[model samples]
Target: MPFPHDRPTRGSDCDCLPRPSDTKGSDAKASDPKPSDPSPSDPALPVYVLRYQDAWFGMEKRVTFAAADLDAALAITEREPIGAWAELSQDGVLLCRRGGEPGGAADYWVVD
Candidate 1:
């Protein structure tokens, strides 16, 4: 069947897929509309520290802090006594060990 614009159908001997040369006079995608999503560059996201427990039934330590990103979260953790006390997370996503390690987690965090 032919396309709405009368373009050739694929696999029927002729295909109307846009070619490099056909893009010279106009840009179809550039003229189309699209819904933009929030990017890392957007300020909608913010780093947060999620406070949880290392062990469910132990008083060894109280809470944990996971940085939303590698920003102030990790930096603030440097001065904190992590390791077995609390773990780190970013953007509500837990990172590193669950029970906590050196407390100095990685920058493995992302934003929408």
Candidate 2:
């Protein structure tokens, strides 16, 4: 199916309008169908962005990842390490790391 942008839309529903078969832009014969994309669809994993500094460039580098969560992102970074000081962002939102193992929530702050 042709995208709305590739072919003019029909109406408010935004359906692709079919091209005339008898003409080429109403001039000559029509051509073959548009070729479909061969690339795979987007990953289902949760999106993550790792923020780190580059040692060579001495500038910050942002690396995006599609994984289960921050833990999964960290695992990939461990294999192909980015930088010593790095932070993780999930779905484009930056997240803070938990200081310790799971215990009581008393040490943390809360709002009403």
Candidate 3:
């Protein structure tokens, strides 16, 4: 549906409003359905990408995984091949593997 800003306001002659031929309450339930609660199969667990620079030689790498906690995700990423120099973000900032090189800034999506 187009945004309200993109459409013209309804006037007295506008036929978009409810008509006598339309079934009111029958379609009302379908129009505004209640949202279901989050479940394990609902894909509620948050997903994030772990990004860091290589320790020995500077190289950027990212790993994506689903985890409940950020710490747990970091722990899982640490077990991977790049675990040695893999730096986890402390305050959701860039994870620095070496002293000088900083990870590029990019907004991560939080899966609902």
TM-scores for the candidates: 0.29, 0.41, 0.34
Sort all candidates by TM-score, best to worst: 2, 3, 1
Worst 10 residues of 2 by lDDT: 103-112
lDDT of 2 by residue, 50-70 (tens): 676554665777777676655
TM-score: the better of candidates 1 and 2: 2
Q: Which of 2 and 3 is ahead in lDDT?
A: 3
The sequence of per-residue lDDT tens digits that candidate 3 reaches over residues 1-112 is 7654456654434455565555654655555645664333346666656676654566778766666666666567656545234545433665434222346543232322
How does model 2 fare in lDDT?
0.52
Candidate 3 residues lying further than 4 Å off, grouped into runs, are 1-42, 55-57, 82-112
Clashing pairs in 1: 66-89, 67-90, 68-91
Local error of candidate 2 at 102, Å? 27
Clashing pairs in 3: none
Candidate achieving the largest lDDT:
3
Give the local distance difference test score of model 1.
0.49
Score candidate 1 by TM-score against the native: 0.29
